[model samples]
Target: MSQTIHINRVGLVALALSLCANAQSPQERSPIGAVLGTSTPVEELSTKASPAVVHIEVSSYRTSADDGDEIKNQTLTKRQGSGSGVIVDPDGYIITAFHVVKGARRIRVELDRRVRANSPAGELLNGKRRSSFEARIIGVSKEADVAVLKIEAQGLPTIAFSESNNLKQGQLVAALGSPEGLRNSLSLGVVSSVEQQIEPDDSLVYVQTDVALAAGSSGGPLVDIQGGMVGINVFSLTQRGREEGLGFAVPSPMVRFVYGQIRHYGFVPRPYFGVDVQGITPTLASALGLPTDSGVIVAGVGPGSLAQNEGLQAGDVLVSLDGMPLQNVPQLTWLLLHKHIGDRTRLEIQRKSSKIVLDASLISEPSDPEGSIATIDIEENLVAKLGIVGSARKHGTAGPSPTASGPGVLVVARLRESDTRAELAAGDVICSVNSVPITSVAQLRATIESFKPGDAIALQLERKGKLMYMAFEMD
Candidate 1:
């Protein structure tokens, strides 16, 4: 009976194939063929979104030998990496993962955007013309692994962003990327879990999916059936040597928020809450004599901060913020993220036995000094060797630099592509170069040019009221 059943199943499959082969007209074709034909929704969605999707190639330097007596001296070797990005602006703003371009000395974008003589950027080509452009890092948020890039082109294709708030578990999503450097590959999968915290105590959340992701997949867009971007593919959780089904993406909302902040400030504004809080577990609540088990407790309050100014103290159990119930640490951070600097909010905490309410406003730490690099003079401020626009200033005048006293060069801006082997950021005050005091922009430039490639240089930097040192090789 089993043999007979197997024979019948094979005969049915053969009959179906013969019928499909015999069909020459559309009307005679099988419904299955038509359903899976060239005009399917998936195909249409891919066609609509693939143009805006781009392949990102990054180049950075790494040491040939990290450790061992056999290799006492480390040599710089060029390393290449690939990832994916989506065009968010027609004027050439692309968004990708921070890891894709971090520590990269050079970044290049490969897109299908039209490259006409007068075209904006990538234009749909006939596989004949090359559409590649060098991109500059606009800003990056390491916490979320989102980075924004800018290319010098216009009329570029861009993808539309859809609200991810309503995404349900088991919803269909497609990932577009160049897995293993195979460009324009698309895979389909379902949302495994909406909220996934890969790390403990991390305030960031990811959109976990069962989507097929590989090495070259980071920074790609995870879109819905309608070709709307829902998330950016970040990483995959692999066990041993297999990738059965574990992928994660930075949620669209968080990416969008970071993008907006970076575009304006050239960095994510660090919100200074002046207070630290943790979740109130059952044990913690009982020990603290709190009323409820599920809540948040103030761990510490910064001195001279608005929290302390408004009577917020340690051991205070926070009940709500602006009437919204507080539960965990992530939720508190998320809620506070919605509040920008100067935004006033109401907080209710269970202090001792009474319910006390405190009203306070939010503030932020000093923004990235690179944000003010605009409109710099080309001739005087530009330090080509170090790739920074600088100005001379007195240390104790602006803010006392305990290490230095008189004149130093203030870094107003930094160019992404430079031979400098270290991260000499804007807002850093250069106190000296290799024990030789640097007073002005000319002195900084001259002192830097005095050293040649392979020479080691140490710079004393004053950043955010602290003195530190940055050392690197001249390349």
Candidate 2:
């Protein structure tokens, strides 16, 4: 999303509060009263910021076959979900949590009247003053839990981003979202912590707040008193599905980084060294006969990977990357996250009392083996008939390197409904058609061309971790 500062809502609010405080100045005030200084209140900030927030509703369609009956007809199931988003660009670019739209076949966004510059006064002829618009997915990064969406509108209200790194603990913050499908709801809290680890080993962190967030609040904006957005509301710690006042958000820096990468590359280009590593503590270092008390130990190097090609092997203790010392797995992971594909970096490794320095190039990590399927481009006629879009999975592409096994035509995206009764989904691997194995896009196209319209065809698909058979008539 592009940056813009049209209204300067936060600045205006701050200025107004400062003037009010000056006007109410006194010769002396109680210590307690001084400590509890008043600025822009939560209600005022919520009202000023609510224009940029939007309600998001999504519908996902999936095909379910009868119990133990593959040849019979299938049923299409619709699952509905709701969340919130903030307009970051007046040109209709929206930022929201990835989980809100994951696997969704259709997405709709509702904007309040205030978002429109020329909207009417505060008058509600109907229940609410809102307008619905169809939203399209621009890109998504599941690892960062951020997704960018686009709606067909212009000159919409937007929220300003705050420097989350400067956020202090106990600072007041407000969360705005559609909690429990209630639009424009507000919650108040303070920053409990700025560095909260989600993974046990990774260095990734989230901003922790004491704000109580509900199910529909995910992807909403966490704003400061001045109405600047500092974080994205994500999830809350709960006991028995009850709120615990322990909410977490993806800090603004990470949100900006992920959003920029997705917008430019269509996906997050996560660099990979193709090596599994573990942190080596002092005790483990002594047992392994290592020189340093802290470092990262390479457990296994992938076959034919850059690590293997560069002579990196199991049991090699990585001491540093480039010039930075890596004392643990998190440090190494953090360093790798900043690197891009084709980036060459020097690595200092210790092997059996011998210190060695080697250079290795990074490559994009391959898609998850269990979740992603190889994609191939089929004939235009077949694509139009099937209402789908796909691309042939290339070998040794710029993105994540593919594994040795599970080579087949991958389904990239599923389009709208067609007359065909076949059920195919994104990330599904089309292994074969009519029992004929398909290895490439050309093969899939040729196989589909062999069958005439109205012919019943059997498709062998690999979804998630299971193999299933689907039968549909060609139309």
Every model's TM-score: 0.69, 0.70
Q: Per-residue alpha-carbon lDDT of model 1 for 1-475, expressed as tens digits?
A: 0000011222233334544655678766473553345554556777888888888998854332321325432223347889999999988899999878765667899885433212354343465444787888888877678899998777777888987777888676778888888788787777778888664346677888777788989999998868999999999988896886788998888888889998998878665457777777788778878888876788898777677888889999888889998776667777876777877788888888899888866777433333333222434676888877677776455543345546788876555455667677656788888888888888888888888899999998887668888999888
Best TM-score among the predictions, by candidate number: 2
Against the true structure, candidate 2 has what lDDT? 0.71
Q: How far is candidate 2 from the true structure (C-alpha RMSD, Å)?
A: 8.6
> What RMSD value applies to candidate 1?
9.4
Off by over 4 Å in 1: 1-36, 61-78, 113-130, 278-296, 304-306, 352-354, 366-445, 448-475
The candidate scoring highest on lDDT is 1
What are the lDDT scores of the predictions, listed in order?
Answer: 0.73, 0.71
lDDT for each residue of candidate 2 in 159-206, tens digit (9 for 90 to 100)? 989888888886667788888888877776778888776653444578
Measured on C-alpha atoms, candidate 1 has an lDDT of 0.73
